[model samples]
Target: MKKQFFYIVLMGLVAPLASCNDFLDMEPMSEITPEDYYQTVDQVEEFTNQLYADILTTHGSYSSTFEIDKDTDNQPSTETPGNKYDNTGQWKVSMDNSSWSWTNIRNVNYGIEVITENYENGTITGDETSLKQYLGELHFLRAYAYFSMLQKWGDLPILTQAFNDDEATLVEASKRSPRNEVARFILKDLDLAAKYMTPDFETSHTRISQDCAYLMKSRVALFEGSWLTNFKDTPFVPNGNGWPGTAKDYNKDYQFPAGGIDQEAQFFFQEAVKSAELVAEKYKNSLTRNTGITPQSVSDVNDYFYMFGDDDMSTYPDVLLWREYNKGLGITNHLEVIVQGGYDVTRSMVDCFLMEDGRPVYNSSIPYDDQTIAKARSNRDPRLVAFMKQPGQINYFINEDYPADHARKDEAFPPLDVGDGTVNRSLTGYRIRKGGSFDKARCDQWNSYTGSIVFRATEALLNYIEAEYMLTRNIQAGHILEYWKLIREAAGFTGAAADPQTTNTYTSIDKEKADWGAYTAGKLLTDVTLYNIRRERRCELMAEGLRWMDLIRWRALDQMCKTPYHVEGFRLWDVMQNEYDLEPADYDGGNDAFVTPPSRGQYIIAYENIQEKSNLYRDGLHWMMAHYLEPLPIKQFLLTSSDHADVELSPLYQNPYWPLVADSPAEQ
Candidate 1:
């Protein structure tokens, strides 16, 4: 089979620059310049295609991609040194210089500038449709780059135009725009993109289409709106206590586009609702179903599992954007292998899934003590059985001959033994089975040609529900019940439809008791409606690199540091230890050195015995308010001060709570 158009883009961008000294140099006959480039629709499209390779394909390693979900309540990495945010004193102001970089923004802006100038100057002729579509893609890509920056560093220097290498021009572009203004700019770009973009791209789901723009607009708006709502009174948001943004003398009394902060939030939430509703309505019937799914057999096509792992996603209309891979071309990834080995789905994440009967897993009918691997796997949400690896379950379908010592191949419930021969074994007993393929031949291949779903309509559904509820606190609005039913139905839950009036017999109260981080921080999900919506999101999108962002926007990291919350694994200490023939000697250190035996029937607290050395919840995970918005690099401030000596201090302001020192400030 021929490789997909996705690889063509990679080759188109890389082949041209492989031998060039400077991509922008004007002199050489061999080198391409802006004048030579953008002369044709093909060149312009290829230029925009590079954005996908740079931004999206950078996450080709499934292990590293999923690692974003680890060290949080939802998941944990088997190899533990703990994440920077987990320690009380590890996260420092100078640790992240890349967040200060604007290379991607500059590239995107340059592309836009070249295209707009060329089109207006009549230097290039094109089918107007193709030219406008390429322009829309650039705008969307620029907005995407800015959205990424906004997430990491709250306020940013909104650089719409590309600057030359001159220092004065660089310094002029360095003044930080207010966070709210940055969000509005992103929305404006998306609106322009939607106006010029086609509804769908012809080359599968890899390219930016009209729906992709709407979905992203919803995602960006919801993130900003929720951040403002949850943290309105805190310093992390603009115009709040200790907020670092300033309206320079020229724009000191700046008013939000929607009057004030509260109104501004409502404005974005409404935008989120508008955009999300459009996509959700357009793709309401796009959910992929396992038509031939059975208790013992799973079809290799047309199912949720295949949608995530298969090389072709054209059949799944719900997937608005996807990255295709080709093994023959040497463009492949081991996402399936990583799913089988590298990470563990936390017990808290598993518990987040509601039972098949639409009840919490912790309901009195299904108490926590009854949660053995076998018991927990039975009658739970079909997703639990479908997406998670249980003890003694076959991981892959192809019956391949292999060394007996292969860590995961044909292994039944690969023990959570870190020292096991396989590098892919889980630290927590629960392994991720979501994207593992049944085809064993492709499992361990270096360039595994499994496609990656970049965006799906499912997210738009969830976004609409959240934005609508947050804006009006009404679950009945915009077919909330209808969309939720679709999610449940897609997950293989066949029951009487969910009723908003009927309270679930099981409450998150018990589950929250085990995961103290659930109730702490500023997370105030007291209402059943909101709690259920949040629960649905967590369960549906687990291990998808979104949990950390959700937690940050919700301001849910504070409680994690209040006390050392135990990051518990499966009830392996109670059940699997004996069942798997595991011994104390199998651990990192023998008996007294490794794990401390839990009281019978209790869950395994990871690294409980050697907490100090393991970095696993030893000091507890903490989040400083300043961490809400990453600090601009101290070097940037120093450069500004030295370059513009006439100005006594740099015009830039540091995010609140971050000291100018290289080390962390005293504990909050």
Candidate 2:
């Protein structure tokens, strides 16, 4: 079943589990009962197969983890891209969260109940290991669904068993559990998954494995721990000050599992460290290495350069799981064009990288010029060089007999002075090369078969480093130190041994203000050590579809409450503007402009170049307390609002500063 990843199994699963309309899609499915259907290991495999494809499918609408991760600080686009992050007013109370409903969880829960009972009661029979692996896959998928829900809406109902449509039963299950409890529940499921699943299940790299379970658990725990620690005494936490949950009877005095916020945070951080270290240890010998070669040096091969682009990701053991698309099967994606032109990797993100001498770029004596793309990437972490695309670098570094693909021009910097359909242009001058390929077959539109990495072991080490620091305040010691070195070395640093202390000591907020990593929850971090720990994670996982989660948990936008943060790209005015057809003054068209004004700053301001007068982020991107957690749509409350005039008694509470009124913005 895992080998069937590249094909059309996703659309053809007869289980009606796509989004179970009722508790378990109670509509007839060939008139098969749980007992009758759960007769073989093959049935179990079919039941849970689509979950792998559907659960984490499209990490974002971009269809690639390495994307122009807009909305967050890392990748900002013009036309007020996802204005919710810029102005709270852009966020109206959703009418319904029906799209992210419990249907997926219910489907997974139904599978769990049936499979466990059938296996235990002899209703199903198969090779013991195979059956357990299938069951474990179900558990893993359920945890993944709940974890995603936790990020969107903090407190989620920890549903373990499938329920009937009894009105009282359904409503009771709708009660949102405290986020920490949900995190713990997710961890428990992951443990069950790991216990039954082995590393590289069925010796296939595409399937859910024990190591993948560990990596995911670490990520989930790190998120909860960080959220708890940062939003400690705020209304965001379960029993924090002015919490909306406290107004409800069920959560009036919500006692945390570890007695209090601080202890509970520590508990989660410990879980993160423990689980992360397990995978970190497992993959200590197998992490990918950077060969210090860019895509331009196609003649001289670099394993790191080709890892993401390679369709056969199975060769890369560090990649725990990747979605393999087959060109023969007519299943492919247009990733090369996106990465070739690149995601709008923020100017601040580029500045965040440290010098090769184990020192902050601001303080290091290394020539720190950022006017050109070459200057910005020079003398910095090798991860920057390996990933950032430059102009004149050939897109077709491999087979070029295809004249159509060969005729494609070398990457050109996009006209920042313009707006509207930026098909294959770099919004920020800095283009991404991480998941890019030069292979002729993958170069064409919608014909790319570059495997999308689902989980990488590098993140487990990163999770361990940050969670340990958050818990113990000691990074660069013991396994933390070892993991830090491993990441730095793999990133092609090729310099002094990895030292977080030296880097932290030199990381000045005033000198490096472009980097929002130094700030947490609107306040500038005085704890430079903690800042550096976060810096490592930021560098390692850039453009990997994890920035939003990291920012939300860090409460990184809190400072935006006091001052809006204008997201900027490379210095277009100083050097690159001459390369384009337009100039600063020429960008004066009220609506038809394609470039940002140079008068604003040296760098290209992403949101300021928009044509729309209604653009909320024309000035700068702002934030709200409620923006961290999505507003629980009104329809959810209305569903249980019956019999309880006060909606608070309806088993759900509006998040933080958001009101119950439909279409209302965050009150804060």
Candidate 3:
């Protein structure tokens, strides 16, 4: 996978998509140099346009962003288990950096170079406004590329310009920057991007704007601040115990830019608050209303329910960045699941949503029951429950677009035929209702036209709340109270109920043991205010592909090393079994005896139910200190070396607790 990622980056081939010109026609890089080809702004814009189409992760299948929460407590899937949580430590060192590929980086660097050089040299003949906007896009794209890898690999090579393949130049440039420096570099790029961008671009919302840049900037700041604060004295951080970066000559005598780690972390917290406030303040009134409408209710369709499936999100003010799919251009998305159970979310996600009255379900007086799926969602947060399928619910909430032949995956007691493909589905009883529509065009394979959101403005709100609390250790400080209130109210709370303090008062840290977010660095978080802040984020961004990042940044699952966690779902052995007409028995090729017995637990265990005792996580999910950061690819080390695969000579360093040998797993 690493080699594949490297190849894509090395080749820098942009697959033609639906565009104004022929996307298939290759850019004649050999014939067109900056002196000749980049004379017009449109020419430069065309090159940058490919970044938008190629970089963003548009919908590819039923399990695109929805499946990102798989290993996290928020969501689990039947489509095999994740190596991170299976306790076998199968996350071995790769031959190449698939996840760490710099394909987009190289492209962005090239665009920035030619455009800036041409504009400064008077070679480009266009308005400064358009040229600056396109340059802003390149900068934003570069920052985005770096931020994505920063989460996976804490330390990264900060590549500002495209480099030649000369051995000395390449090896010298491979020196890994400290994680904090990489984060700072990303923020600087975003700063330039925002300075060059407009608040409202003439182009549609599909393009990145100043608001989007600020939101992403806030996200990166909050992430780094949280990580540095949580892993203060750990090997994963620079200058900390057993830090691998300190082993290399360039990083061995590193000095914190802010004097110390604590000061540096505070700097990020301030940056997070500063950038987030810019976006949140502007878009606070723009949060889409939650109409509290379910499929079972007799209300006109809720706009919030259709936000993810809508073909156009340009009008939605709070949606910072989104991708529009056009069927006419042969650029379509395929997320149709013929069966309702393709992407199953975990029950913990349901529990994460607070009761509309601002209280956790464990302590709420709202007469809630956990035995059935319906009872669990009753009177809870509307936005969270809206995407969770309930019994007797229609497969398509609004089916004006689907045709007669369009197959429906309507809920019929959470279909649990766990052997074949679609016939055996819905691993957990909880089904994901995100990106679902009755549109026949969308239901067709590779023919959907729904817009895919790359960045939502709500992230700014989430980042501000967490950053403020982390910095001051008080939600009352700064605009944390105001920002948090907006989020709570948007989720359907009102008056005193909308106040975050109310939830903080009623919250019990012990009761939140099931939630991985409740812990940081292997111990329960003592402050209730911060826990509630985290709870809001977990609820708001359930399956939007940010859960894993949150979990590791907080060091949430560090306790798993001693006390492993079982991946559980709906209560199949309880009265729900009778409601769903399921029999609790041992597995026999997934016939009638597919479910795990009552001895395992009343709720469904995703891994424990497997046959022949072949379950990888039968011992439950566990973690190690080394698991926080991925080991560097062996090929990266080899390329950085003066001669042969001499890892010692290489300026790049492997992550702490990870092995230097190829294909080897973590030492911990």
Candidate 4:
């Protein structure tokens, strides 16, 4: 079924390129010449679809490892020597690696240029509505590409057009714009895209729609606003101390396009609220619910579970955009298989989930050391049960090839036991079950066709709440309380039903105190409302590739460096190890094997432990403020240096605290 759909879309995409052979095969200089092509709206739409296939596909979304969520505070990876971002001291400047490339920007700008020029000249002889819609998609793609660049490299060279191959023109275009100015430019494109985009939702949820644009606007605005607010005193943000961005001589005293930084933040935050409100109001019913265990619904326990693992998300109205994978089309990923205990879930994440009674897990009567798996998970948020692989839970059924000896039977999984000397086991005993399909046939396969969600209305709701809370700093605001109620109700909070009036009981003040990421360590969050809001986001969006970005925008990593914070796993040595055979002969003696003479009470520790058993970070996790923004490649400076003979300094400035080296060891 998905194959047919892929072929249908592929045919639509291929037809335009096939028809415009002459235009496509034109000289490199005249390849994007508007007069040559851009004749029909169908062709324009087809061209825009290429952008979706190229830039927005799931293939482009994933990093080298499918598990991008690993190595964070919430999720720990199996491999030692934690992710480069976590290793602050070892990080160094590279000569070639950077996000300054313009390949995608050129593609998007070329499409926009062709559409704008052709539409203005009255050359596009097709349905104006279709042309406008495609134009909207191009603008959205351009904004998305620019935002991606802005996130990696603070300031960027804002280019709305394809540049010629002339060296002089290329050199002039390399000037970096202010981060705030770049953000405003992205918002400008989003506004245009939203203006021209079709108002109706796309049933496929794969294409860029008005809602997607609005969602992205909210995301971009909130990211910039939060970055400015959190790191206002640092050089990472615009108008901050040691900021290197300079306006051209003509605009020496260039004012912020929005206003002063504070006012600018408010403007963006308001925009976030406005756009997110539109999505929440429009798709309020699309939110997935955790309808409690019913006789008829017993087969599919949680709607939220299948929302991530299902082959199709067309039924979920909240999903604004998703990438559909088809095995027959040779477009599939192993995410479904990987989520099943492949990437380890950390204890920190497990503790984040609120109790079923809307209280923190720590606030329960059971002591920390005495809490069993069942005790820890008991009366917790339904999402925890739905998303995590609990002890002794039946995950899937295994069918026997020979029926004479055996019949198909359900596989009862054991508790999170990592020191078991198994390769596929979780590094941290806790494992992720969020994206795993319950069906054995699907879960067992390598490349399952389960769709990946790109944008969902749940994110918009969270965005609106956070943006509003940030702007007003009033958690008990009428609208804020209402949205919180909606989210908790949909999530199947136990207290949600009784608390119709939306009282503060559901907001556990005690739970806020127990939150590890809050107030303690380096985090300065003091307000319970603010802490709870962040907690909601952390719980709802766990292992969704959003944690890293959240930490960056919130500037939360500084807290990790303040203390000897350890990335701890389950109580493997203390209790979980007993679940497996302890004999020395049972071990494989591989690098992933349990430490010899396994030390008691020492789970996977971030820093070196006295037992020398499970230490991934021997040197300890140290974070430098300079790591907040990646350094520009030194090769860029060298190239610019060649343009001038007498200058000892390069034309561009390196990111603050990042020493510019002429050359360095190539990235492995």
TM-scores, in order shown?
Answer: 0.88, 0.92, 0.92, 0.84
Every model: Cα RMSD to truth: 6.0, 5.0, 4.8, 7.3
Badly placed stretches (over 4 Å) of model 4 are 1-36, 57-66, 81-88, 246-254, 292-298, 365-372, 397-423, 443-446, 496-521, 583-603, 606-616, 642-649, 663-668
For residues 385-482, could you state the per-residue lDDT of candidate 4 as single tens digits?
66665555655433223221111123223323344443364445566566655544544345566787888788888899889988998876636777
TM-score ranking from best to worst?
A: 2, 3, 1, 4
Order the candidate numbers by lDDT, best to worst: 3, 2, 1, 4
Candidate 3 off by > 4 Å: 1-31, 59-63, 295-299, 336-342, 397-406, 580-593
For TM-score, candidate 1 versus 3, the one ahead is 3
Query: Model 3 — which ten-residue stretch has the worst lDDT?
Result: 1-10
User: Looking at candidate 4, what is the lDDT of residue 440?
Assistant: 45
Candidate 1 clashes between residue pairs 3 or more apart in a chain or in different chains: 341-424
lDDT value for candidate 2?
0.74
lDDT (C-alpha) at residue 78 in model 4? 54
Which one is best on lDDT? 3
* Model 1 TM-score on a 0 to 1 scale: 0.88
lDDT of each: 0.67, 0.74, 0.75, 0.64
* Residue pairs that clash (backbone atoms under 3 angstroms), model 4: 356-379, 356-380
Candidate 1 residue-wise lDDT, 1-668, digit = tens: 21111110111111122233543333212245565778878777777777766656333444335556776788865555344455556667773376566666667777787789998887767687888888998898889888888888887778776444444545556777778789999999999999988766465877788999999999999999988887886767777766656434423555677888899999999999999999999888878864323122354343776777777977788988887778788787767666655357767777776666677765635454434766766667777767666555665565455322223644466455545465655555666666666555666646466777778899999999889988888877777888888877787766552443332335655455544234535444466777777778887787777886787777766654455556666776655666765555554343333443554236765555444454445433545555666766566665555343323366566777766655555234
